[model samples]
Target: MSDDAPVKADLDEIRGLLSVMPKADEAARDAARAREGQLTKPPGALGRLETLAEWVATWQGRTPPRIERPRVAVFAGNHGVAYKGVSAYPIAVTAQMVANFQAGGAAVNQLCAANDAELRVYEMALDHPTADFTDGPAMTEEECATAMAYGMMAVEEGIDILCLGEMGIGNSTSAAALAHALFGGKAQDWTGPGTGVTGSTMELKIQVVDEAVTRHLPEMTDSFDALRRLGGHELAAIAGAILAARVGRVPVILDGYACTAAASILYRADPHALDHCIVGHLSAEPSHRRLCEAIGKQPLLDFGMRLGEGSGAAVALGIVKSAVACHSGMATFAEAGVSDKD
Candidate 1:
């Protein structure tokens, strides 16, 4: 059998899995809300945290959600568009950052360590970047599907929460193209300074995005087509990971713009996919807020974070853990013998 056969099979399996993503358990959410009402705290005193607890419970299909064995998978790939000088950094930085991730020296490594989350980095051929989308499709459909299958395979047993991250120079350009295609927006609206490019470099990035979007817009019939035409391997893999986590009933924490762009593909593919996702933070990237709005996710943090590699998601894990702890450990009025409000 050809190697592509397995990948095609895997992609088929992913489609089946996406079709069956169970809705969040409204019963569990109701139970959590009831328990929160009964907690010793004043009604609505805990505010959004209370809602967060219930949200987690609903998605987890349980009353007291536990964020156990949190895992952050950072997918790294190279973009052919990087050769166009669309980004401040060179394409070589993609491989170098992947090495940094593996070496446990990157910011994500430190953040994952601090959050007690396991970090896995996938080097999806940064050495051989995808074809420049301005000229043609970024990858063959089979190759894109294979990359996504690799992402779906990242979800191991016992992982309760999955965080998505990406490392690809010029990925912002790819992401801009994706946003333009998916949202039917101007390229400038989705374009941003990735890694601190400004002035003429930023203009070049926008121009590149416009060129790619215009070239691919006619053929961008669906999310998969958009991905194949304009997405980095890392982005496609992240979409696969999101779909896998949803099917596995594992909640997902999304990172910044690039990561969200990947998740947006999954969201567009299956609206139910966002039912299992938590926006980790709002990125400083100008287009990130729009992506969050497009996905209907309010970020858990808003510290202007733009660093990828799941740094924001790793940081937000603390908030999730605290919310879970509150849900599980807080005493109810009956347990605490507290007087009920009149």
Candidate 2:
């Protein structure tokens, strides 16, 4: 840091300055549940959606809430480890899908349009098909500074809710590597057969992550170091955006493996970060369920989804919206002239 600049030497101090009191909103939840029971339906008839709305009320700290214009930001970058054939798709697919997202040709695009959520796409610095798996998916310090500037700018653009997505091809390997680094486990514990890779290819994928970790373990003694060493450009930026959103008091939805890995990194940096996040779905990645469990989050859906365009998060928007609506809009039994079943 320069002499003229604010020193960022203490993460604890930064957290202390930004951390807000978390409201459990128990009253709001109880009221919503009571209203749900009186909704002209049997108890628990609405399944998880009813419970989901109650949680949304608690998250928003209101008897009735509103999540106006939720924003989905998809970060796109290429991983250097793709040359090892760990992924089923080519590195070009990163840029290709980034274009698709911008052009509204991807699944996330359709879901965002259907749900009427605002979407933003950022291209974190990705070079073409580099083989330096040891370096990582992100850029140098200068690049991170630049990305932070853009991320903070996005936070200023008025987002009530946030969700993260990734479009990198070999990022599953990077995601597994980040999970192992953040969670202290074997690569096999956090890796899965991503995007239809065969069993032999999966083995190779695990070996690559193990090698990347082994090569960098000696140099990394901290969470940020491990992230800077093993995390992708988009993943690192997503981590930054997550932290930024959390500090800014906006709830963030996490997509599948790669986006979840970014959340894991942020939580390692600051455990309080998890308090502001919601898990969008349980992915088809064999390791994803375990990863979500590690964070004590049960995803709202499980459609055998392996597609990571933030589709899961996009789909969850309705549940969140309905939850907000019920919390803010529904009348209590007394107000609506109905008797409580209980």
TM-score for candidate 1, please give it: 0.95
TM-score of every model? 0.95, 0.84
Candidate 1 residue 25 C-alpha distance from true site, Å: 1.4
Residue 229 CA displacement from its true place in model 1, Å: 0.5
Candidate 1 minimal-lDDT segment of 10 residues: 1-10
Tens digits of per-residue lDDT for model 2, 284-304: 998898888877788887888
User: Which runs in model 1 stand beyond 4 Å of their true positions?
Assistant: 1-13
* Global Cα RMSD, each model: 2.4, 4.4
lDDT of 1: 0.85
Clashing pairs in 1: none
In candidate 2 the C-alpha lDDT for residue 54 amounts to 70
- Candidate 2 wrongly placed segments (more than 4 Å): 1-51, 58-63, 128-131, 135-139
Output the lDDT of residue 336, model 1: 89
Summarize candidate 1's per-residue lDDT along 1-342 as a digit string, tens digits. Answer: 122335543445566676787888889999998898898889889777888788788877888888879999998889998999888888888888887888889999998888889999988876678998888999987778888888888888789888889888989889888988898778899999989999999998989899888888887777888998999889989988888777777888999999999888877887767788889999999999998898799998999888888899999988888888888899998898988888
- lDDT value, residue 341 of candidate 1: 89
